[model samples]
Target: MMAPEDAALNGHETDKISVLIIDDDSQVCRFLSKIFTGMGYSVSHELTLTQGISHIFSGRVDILFLDVNLPDGNGLEAINTIRHHPSPPEIIVITADDNVDGAEIAMKSKAWDYIAKTGSSKNFRFALERAVEYRRQKKASLSRNDIRREGIVGESRGILKCLEKVAVAAHSDIPVLVTGETGTGKELFSRAIHACSPRCSEPFVVVDCAALPEHLVESTIFGHTRGAFTGADRDRTGLMKIADRGTLFLDEVGELPLEIQKKFLRAIQEKKFRPLGSKTEIHSNFRLICATHRDLEDLIKKEKFREDLFYRIVSLTLHLPPLKDRGEDVAGLALNHMKNQHGANLKNGCIMSRPFMEELQIYDWPGNVRELFNTLDRVCAEAGEGATLFPHHLPEHIRAFNIRHRYAVRQTETPDPETGSFEGPLVPSEPLPPFKDHMEKNKAEYLGHLVAVTQGDIKACCRISGLSRGHLYRLMQQYDIKNNADS
Candidate 1:
C-alpha cells in the first residue's frame, strides 16, 4: 500500500479542499504541506509517482501539485496518468527547472496551471484558488443540466401533488421509497427519478428483490470470485458494483430476507462490500430507490422485514395514485395509449364513441392503468379494421355495467294489509295488448321517454342505448315520436 496521510479535524466539519503534493525532495514536500495546512487545507504529500497515482485512484486528492523530477519517473508524464482518473483532480505543475517543452507538455495534458518553483507566493496562491473555484462551478453546471423527467401522465390533484415531491426528490442524492399498489408504474417512477438526477448518464440498475431465490441472492447482488463458492467457475461483478456512481433500484423491497437486510445495511452505511468469499472490499457509491406494493410497516410488525434497514433506506417517500382516482387523466391516458398503438394508420378514425367514454369514466379500474391499456388494446384488435371503438365493442362485463343509485331500494313488491294482493309502482293504462304488440308498444314508449330525457340530443340518446345515432333516429321516426325537439 502507498503511504496515506490525512490531517485530523478538531471535531469541526467543513468541505475542506484536499491537496496532494508530489515531489521527491523531502524538505520541499514538508514545506509546501505546512503552507497549505496553515491555510485550512487538508494536505498530503507523496515522494514518488507510484504513491501519487495510488492516492488519486483511492478517491481522494482534489488538486495535485507535481514536481518535474520523481524517484521512479518524470512528473510531466505523470500528468497523463493523473488526468485518466474517472473524476480527475485539477493539476498544477510546480517544477524548479521550468522550460518551454515542459510548459507545452503541461498544457497538452490539460493541466490547470503551470507554476515555477521560483515564482512568487502570490502567483502560486492565485492559481490554486482559481482551480478550486473552477471545479466547483463545473460541478454546479453539470447538476443544472441533468434534470429531464418524462413519461408520467396525469393532471389530477393526487398526481400533481406527487409530481411536486418527485421534482424535489430528484435534486438530492438520498434514498427514496416509492409506495403504490401493483401496476402503478413504480419502475417508470424510478426511471424518471434517475433521469432527473446528477447521475443521469450513469447506469440505472434494477434488482427485483422478490424474483431472486434464496441461494442466488448473495451471488447476484454482491458478486463472487472464481472458485469462491461451489460451481463458481468465473469472476462475476455484483449489481452493486455495476450500479456504482449511479442509481440502484430495488423493486419489491419488502421481500428481502432479514439476513440479507443485515448485510446490506452495513454495506450501505459504509459504501463498501466484499464478494461472497473475497478478502478485499469493493466500494459502491450508488443512489438508492426502493419500491414495494406491500406495506413495509406491517411487514416490520410481523417480523418479516427489518425496522432498522427500513429507516436507513426511506430517506424520502412518494406515493403514486391509482388510475381509479385520476379522474380526467384516465381519458387522457387512454387517448395516449390508443395513439401510441394506432400511430397514423387509424384512417377510419380511432375515436371512442360517446358511450365508450362514459363507460370508461364510471367503471372502477381495479387493475389500474395496466389493465386499462390491456383492455383497450384487446378491444381495438378485436374490432378488426375500419370499425371505431364503440361501447358495444367493449368487453361484455364493462359494456353491461351501470352505476346504481346509492340510496335507491330494490324494486320488490310488498303485500297490502287491507287486501290479500301485492302492490305495484305502476298500472297499465288499459288491458295489455297481444304479447308481440305489447313488446313493440313498450319499445316505442321507452324510445320516446329516452328522447324526452335527452331533450332530442341524438348523440346523448345513442350513448344511453349503446346504438348508432342513425339507428336511434330511424327508431324515433318509426315510433311516430313527435315532441318540441322537432322544432
Candidate 2:
C-alpha cells in the first residue's frame, strides 16, 4: 500500500481511483496507460475481455474502458456480466468503428460514454474526466437520496388511503396485518411503516415465513440454547429477541406452522418467551407487522389458524390494491420506474410513445407494481438514446400477453366494506339482481373458490379477491366450512 503522504502527492493513485482498460489493440492500451499514469491515475490494462472480467473481480476497479469490438467477446456481453456484480464499475466504450448503431446500444446498456478509437487523445481524456465527474455526482445523490424509497410510487386516492393507514399503524405498538397480493409492495409498506415508527432507529428485521424450513421453524424464530439441538454449537438469538425495541416484519405469516404459531402468539401477547433448552424466560419488545396474501378467517374455520392469535395481531389492517385498479396513476408510476432505472438526470429525458402507454394502461399486471417496474427497467436498459419507447420496447412476453381483461371491470358480489359477522342481523338487498333469489345463492361458491386458490391462506385470498377478512369470516359461517379445533 502507498504511504498516506505519497498517495496524496500521486493524485492518480489506486486509492484515489482505479481504472481498468480493456482493448484488443496493444498500442492503444500502452498509449492510454502512459497517459493515465502520467496524470497519476493507477491503471490496469487487459488485452482480452476475459482478462478484463477477471481483473474486475480480482481488483478494485472504479471504472472500465471497454472496447466495443473485442477479440473474444463483445463489450455489450461484458457490460451485462459486470452489472450482476456488486457495486458494478462504470463503463466507457472505446470503439474504432463509426457505427452509430453500436454507440446507441452502448448508451442503452448504461455506458458512461462512447468514443471512437480514432478520436484524439485529448478527446479521450475529456471523455474520461466527464465520466468520472458524472459518477461522483451520482454517488453523492444516492447517498443524499437514501431516505426516499425507489419502489411503491403513488399519490392517488386509493394509494393515499393505504399510506394513511400504514402511517397511523406505525405510531402505535399494535400488531398490524398487511393484506396484499403478491408483488403489491407489502415489504415496501412494511419498511415505510417502520421508518415512521418510534423504533425507526432500531433494527428492522424480516422473517420470511414461507421460506423457513418446517423442522427449523421453532429454532429460527425462538432461537436455541447451546447443546439444545444436534447442531447447537453456540447460543443464538431468535428473530424476536434480535428485533427487541424495533420492528419485526413477518412476511407470508400464513405459512407459519400451527406449532410455531402457538409459541409465536405467546411471544406477541406477552413480549416474553423462553428460548429452546432454556428454563429462564427472555423479554423482548418489538412492534410486529405481519403481512400475508392468505385468508385468516377461512384458515381459522379450517382449524389451521389460531383465532385468538388473529384477534391479537390484527389490531389494524392495511389492504393494498393491485395495480390495475389505480387509474392514471399507472403512467406516473411508470415514469418513476424509468427514473429509478436510469437516474435522476434521465427523468423526462425519454418519452414512452402513446401506443406504449396505451398498452401498458390496458394490461392487467398480475404481478402488480413489481412486474411493471421490472419491465420498465429492462426496457430502459435496452432502449437507445433519442429512442422512442414503443410497445416493442417491452419484453416479448408483455407485448404478446393476450390481455383478455383489458376492458374488463372487476365484479364485486359482496358489499364494498364487508363488515359484521354472520351472527349479526341481515340487511336485505336494496332490490336484488335480475336473478332475484339467486343473488345471495352462490355466496358459498365464491368463498370456496377464493379459499381454495389460496390453499386455505385466508390473507392471500382476501387480497387477490379484494374481500376483507371480516367478510370472509361471515361468508364461511354461512357456507358451513367445517371448523378445525386444533387451530
Candidate 3:
C-alpha cells in the first residue's frame, strides 16, 4: 500500500493518480490494482466495505471505485459516513448490477460517477480519467476564490497562521467558529471563506444574532408556517433555507438565547428543520460559519450555551488577533484603504510622513480594523482642499492616543554612548538645550510635529505653525528633516 502522504501528492505528479479499489472479489481488486499500477498510479485495494471507508478517511485516496453490493453491506449505507469527512475522496461506483435507482441514490449522495462492472479495463481507465479531470477543475475553482477579497492581508505571524487554517478549512463543508474582540474583521474573514468555497456562486447570508429578539430567534433562523404565530400571516423561509446551497454567517453568535441553542443544534446536525407550527421538516444545505466577540467556553460553563452545539459548530475555530497585535499591517492597511478610497485624489493624497506613519504603527487600535478605517476617513476628510493626508486629519482621540504611546515608548530612556548616564536624545526626562546651542534640535522637533499633525503638507504646516515658507525650508535644512513631506 502507498503511504497516505505519497498518495495525496499524486495529483501533482505526471502519470500518477491516487486510486482506491473496493470490491468483494479478490480477483477484481487484483485486476484493477495491477492495471492501475502499470499506468504509474498509486492504488490501494480493500476486500471489505468497512476497510474501504477507513482507507478513504486515511486521506490516501483521490478516487474511490466502490462496489455497489459489498459482501459486508450495500455501498449506499456508507454514503453518509463518507460525506462527513473534511475532504471526502471522490467516489465512483462499480457494480455488476446496473440500476437507475442505485445510480440516482449514489449521485444524490455526492458520488462523482457510476459505472457498471462490465469487466472491461478500457472502460475503467476512461472512468478514472474523467474523475481526475473533474477533481482538477474543482480544485482550480477553489483557488480563484481564495485570492479574492484580499483574504486577511497581514504580515504578522499570528494572522498568517490563522489564514493558513482558513485555507485548509475552506475545502471542507465543516462548520467554523471565529472568535475575536469587537471590530476584528470577523465578518470579513467569514465572507472570504465562503467565497473561496465550492459554493462561491451561491448567496452568502448573514444573521445578526445579537439583534434578534429572544422570542423571535427561532422564527428568524428556522422560518415559520402560515398562521403559526400571532403575526404569521404567510409562510416564510428562514435564513437557513434562504441561504440553501450557500453560507450562513451568524454574527455575535454568543448572544443567541440558551433555549434557541437546542433548536440550532438539531438544524445543524440534520441539515433539516420544520418551520414553527409546521409538521413537515424542510431541508436546506448551507455551510455554517459563526462569529462571536464573547468567550463561549465561559458561557458554556455558566450553562448559557449548549456544549453539544458548541462542538458541532466549532469543527474548526479561528481566533483572530486584535489590530494592535498585527504590528506592521496597520500602516499597510492605511495606505491600501487610502488608495482604494481616494484613487482620483492620489495626487493630493496625504503622503504619510515617516514620523506620522511610525506613530500610527505604534498606537494600539482598540476598535481594530474598523477603528483604523474610521481614523483614515477622518484624516482624509479633515485635510485642507488639494491637501494630502496629515496628522491633523485624524480625530482627536486617535491623535491623543498616538501621543500617549510615543510618551510611553520614550519613558524607557535608552542610554546614549556619549553620556555616562542612560540619558539619550529625546528622552522624556532630559530637557532640550536653549535656542542658540540646540537651535537645530528645536527646529527638527517643531517641524516634525507640525508635519505629523498636518499630514505632511508643508504649506499647511507653515500656515498652522505661523512659519513662513522660506522659514520652513531653512528649518528643514537645520534639523536634517526631509523637505518632501508632500511626497
- What are the Cα lDDT values of the candidates? 0.78, 0.76, 0.78
lDDT of 3 by residue, 1-487 (tens): 2223323333345335689998999998998999888877799899999888888887757788888888888997687887788767788888888699999999898898888877678888888888888876675556444645573567687776566556755778878888899988899889888877899999999999999988888999999999999989999889989999999999999999987888889989999999898999999999999999988888888998888888887767777999888877988887787667744444344566666677688778888988887776655444533454445455656666775676565675677767755544554466845535553454468678777877778777765654568877787777767645546
Best by TM-score: 3
Ranking by TM-score: 3, 1, 2
When 2 and 3 are scored with lDDT, the better candidate is 3
Off by over 4 Å in 3: 1-146, 342-350, 419-487
Please report the TM-score between candidate 2 and the true structure. 0.51
Q: Native-vs-model 3 lDDT?
A: 0.78
Candidate 3, TM-score vs. the true structure?
Answer: 0.60
**Runs off by more than 4 Å, candidate 2:** 1-150, 342-351, 381-386, 400-487
Give lDDT tens digits, candidate 2, residues 35-144.
Answer: 87786677889999999998898767887899988889998767889987776888989998998998899889988889888889998788777777777667545533
TM-score-superior candidate, 1 or 3: 3
Q: For model 1, how does the per-residue alpha-carbon lDDT over 130-219 read when each residue is reduced to its tens digit?
A: 988897677545533443536577778887666655655687787888889898889888888888878889999999999999788888
RMSD of 3: 12.7
